[model samples]
Target: MFIRTENPQTFIKFYPVTVAILVLQIAIWTIYLLPLPSVQMWSNLMTGFNLGIAKGEWWRFLTPIFIHASFSHLLFNSFSLFLFAPALERMLGKVRFFLIYIGSGLVGNIGTYLIMPLEYMHVGSSGAIFGLFGVYVYMVLFRTDLIDRANSQILLTILVISLLMTLINQQVNMIAHIFGLFGGLAFAPLLLNKKSDGF
Candidate 1:
């Protein structure tokens, strides 16, 4: 399910939302890498700073979903989205997928703001990517019609590995990963209740 079978032309046309998100992430990361002071300042401003959120900079929650701490961070998330997101986008349609994507990220950031120390700060789309995992989990467990047994098993294995990695990776925001996952599970039923188009 995670494989990229679609060629560039078809992928762009079929999964515009996923493509757009990948483009936005890369563009923002590119600007963030610039040596200019203004770019650095802007990048700093966009991170998920718990103190900044407490200071009423609420946009930090949303903006951090697109920002990454390093080229590897951006590339990993972008590649994950490129490979895995298109299926959900195809199944859920553009609008609902976008809502889940952003909403899950917000849930992660808000959870971080509420739980983390005021001095804490973070950036990356791991929360959002994990949110996608949650959605797939929901499918594996409840919405069996959406995914076959073989694919479900594969997803479960990946999910286990992912959670293990999240725990092992000291740099990752554990709260955001956990919260974003629940966020996706929380959003799944409501969003998936309606009939979705099969990919």
Candidate 2:
């Protein structure tokens, strides 16, 4: 059975929003990495939000993903966002995709805060990227026709590789990735299948 879906509106769609946010993140990080005082100060501003929830600064949940440790980190995340975000935006539409990204990232940060000590600050878009991965996996499993077997296998392989990379890179917040994956998996099936009669 075909999982009839609408084509995303190319001109007024979620891709632009995702691209804009990622670009802003990259720009902020790039400036922070520079030697300028203004950029440096703005960069350090994130430190105030690092353990925000524990400190009663709840806004940190949203701010953490915008902060990155280094240029290479920001570059890799921006590339991943550029690559995977459009597909998600096209499939889920702008609002849903935005919800998934932000929700998953916030959940990830909360999980990190709960498990890891406050001294070890965590930040990055990896959690949200992993959420995209979880959504892809869910689509492959329950909405099998949405993605073919070959594509599913490829995505799964990539997910495994990404997990391994996170493991090897000790600084990465592996717990956040795990939490985001579970959060996306829990939400994707519910959101994607709402219109269908099948249970």
Candidate 3:
């Protein structure tokens, strides 16, 4: 019943943070889709441009995840969040979820910035999504009962496919994806619940 419901409130109650992020992405994209020529400027302000960071415009470290370069990029990220984020939110609860999401995203962006050319620009929620995947992998290992065997296999399969895709695609920022995952793994030990001792 929970999986197939028409009630928006049900979704909000169980997946508040996920729903909020989805709404934020949609609102941003709505602006991106507008006819005004100024719309392109959003990316300029939001993208993770190393040059901007070097100049002490440090917010670029976190803002890039909200800016998507293409419709397909946004679509895939939205789908990934809608499909996986709610379960992760439930697994880690609200505070840990928030911390892990942002922390991993920062790590991903920092990793990319260190290696990527200064003039290069990167945008999209892929790093945060990878963080979600990383957190889920940790859950599978330490919080097994929360995720059944089927979901564990599915998560593992997703991680493998994502890694392969990162390797094969030259345009993709493998640094962000790889480090985002590692960042999540590292956070799990400190943030993930080891027992029923409250997350």
Candidate 4:
């Protein structure tokens, strides 16, 4: 027996770009994980404080988002990004979505730099994924229809799941997730509004 589902076109349309970007990121990291000198050299480029904005290595802020410590780590993060990003991109448009992704990742890195000791090394896209969740929650909260109610429930569900996951997995960077959420919350209003607010 076949089960009929509501519109799956959204899922189908987004898979290509999301999957391609994530696959490329995974492939690059896989190469970097290899012991080859070339791979090692490439890997060194993403070390947190080794290359940082304070040191004029601004790219490191963004580069770390694409780097993962293990295959499972990469898979989990990439899958989350793939799942949520397309819907956000469709709603916010490519430019806004890209800004949210990069901005949140940078905010996450900044939080790490401030909270963790300088020698501590960290990398993952979880920060950005959390940012996407934050944005979705914000959008849902502002809506006034039945969809809004549904989305609010979804947001609450995600929060509960995040809490559970963080509690269960000590390796997860809960601090980064919190920081990314705050970053997205702070930025969304400014970006979404047309009126100019003096800073």
* lDDT of every predicted structure (CA atoms): 0.88, 0.74, 0.81, 0.69
Local error of candidate 2 at 140, Å? 1.8
Which portions of model 3 show Cα errors greater than 4 Å?
Answer: 1-7, 142-146, 196-199
User: Which candidate should be chosen as best, given lDDT against the real structure?
Assistant: 1
Judge candidate 4 at residue 2 and give its lDDT: 12
Residue range 90-196, candidate 1, lDDT tens digits = 88889999999999999999999999999999998888888998998988778887888888888888889989989999999999999999999999998985566
- Alpha-carbon shift of residue 31 in model 2 (angstroms): 3.1
Number of the predicted model whose TM-score against the real structure is largest: 1
- Residue lDDT tens for model 2, 168-189: 9888889889988877887787
Model 4 alpha-carbon miss at residue 155, Å: 2.7
Name the regions of candidate 1 deviating beyond 4 angstroms: 197-199
Q: Candidate 1 at residue 27, lDDT? A: 93
* Higher-TM-score candidate of 3 and 4: 3
Whole-model alpha-carbon lDDT for candidate 1? 0.88
lDDT of 4 by residue, 65-99 (tens): 87888889988887677656766665565677778
Name model 4 segments beyond 4 Å from true: 1-20, 50-56, 144-147, 193-199
Clashes of 4: 0
lDDT of 3: 0.81
Q: Which stretches of candidate 2 lie over 4 Å from their true place?
A: 1-14, 34-38, 47-51, 193-199
Which model is ahead, 3 or 4, in terms of lDDT? 3
Q: In model 1, what lDDT does residue 36 have? A: 99
